[model samples]
Target: MPVKVRGGLYNPYDGHIDPYSVTQALAAGARHYGAVLRPHTEVTGLRLREDGRWTVTLGHGAQLTARRLVNAAGGN
Candidate 1:
């Protein structure tokens, strides 16, 4: 998310359309393609362990472990 791209529709031509729904649809497709979609969940913390794995702590008191953390969190 850039400073200028606050709303969902970051394109100037398609500025009239809502970007939120587009993002949701993409998330659904990604989930169908083996992606995990965690909506409305805030990442309270991310820590890289000595074993080279990452730990993600959610605001809801949930913890998840993964190999890496790719913070493509803006659109999804």
Candidate 2:
């Protein structure tokens, strides 16, 4: 089970669990089930190439081209 916390609402149902810790645990659990972990990376743009591939540009000029792309940015 996991707890959801936002802006320190202080929900009473969740047992003594920190929101940040729970978030970290959930992310780890996701990665454990075959997920790619990329930290401190930003996607600037994505474009479909002529060969039916995706080219992604990051903030640090890091570019990666792949046949598929999954954008999972947390809401601001």
Candidate 3:
């Protein structure tokens, strides 16, 4: 089991996650729950709609309506 890690030493951790495996697992789980995963898609613009929905613009003039958005881009 992995424990909560708080910074103390130069490098202190009890566990690590395989990025590739975790990503694949998350994608699979999302798909299993009927969520569409669009790879290679870039967000170009964002707009708030009057109906409380979000208008997300993607690369190459694609757009989508999302009820929620999460900023999961870590250090990128």
The prediction achieving the highest lDDT against the true structure is 1
Clashing pairs in 1: none
* Residue 48 lDDT, candidate 2, scale 0-100: 93
lDDT string for model 2 (1-76, tens) is 2455444545688668777887798789978976566776898989999999989898989898877665657846
Model 2 earns a TM-score of 0.49
Q: List the residue pairs that clash in candidate 3.
A: none
Alpha carbon deviation, residue 18, candidate 1 (Å): 5.4
TM-score rank, highest first? 3, 1, 2
Rank candidates, lDDT, best first.
1, 2, 3
Lowest summed-lDDT stretch of 10 residues in model 1? 6-15
Residue 35 lDDT in candidate 1: 70
What lDDT tens digits, residue by residue, belong to model 3 across residues 1-76? Answer: 2455432223257456676787799789978977776666788999999999999898899899987776444434
lDDT of each: 0.77, 0.76, 0.74
* Model 1 C-alpha lDDT versus the unseen true structure: 0.77
Winner on TM-score (1 vs 3):
3
Q: State the TM-score for model 1.
A: 0.53
How many clashing pairs per prediction, in order?
0, 0, 0
Candidate 1 per-residue lDDT over residues 1-76, each given as its tens digit = 7887765535766547555787689778977977776766799999899999989999988999987555667553
Query: Stretches of candidate 2 above 4 Å error?
Result: 1-35
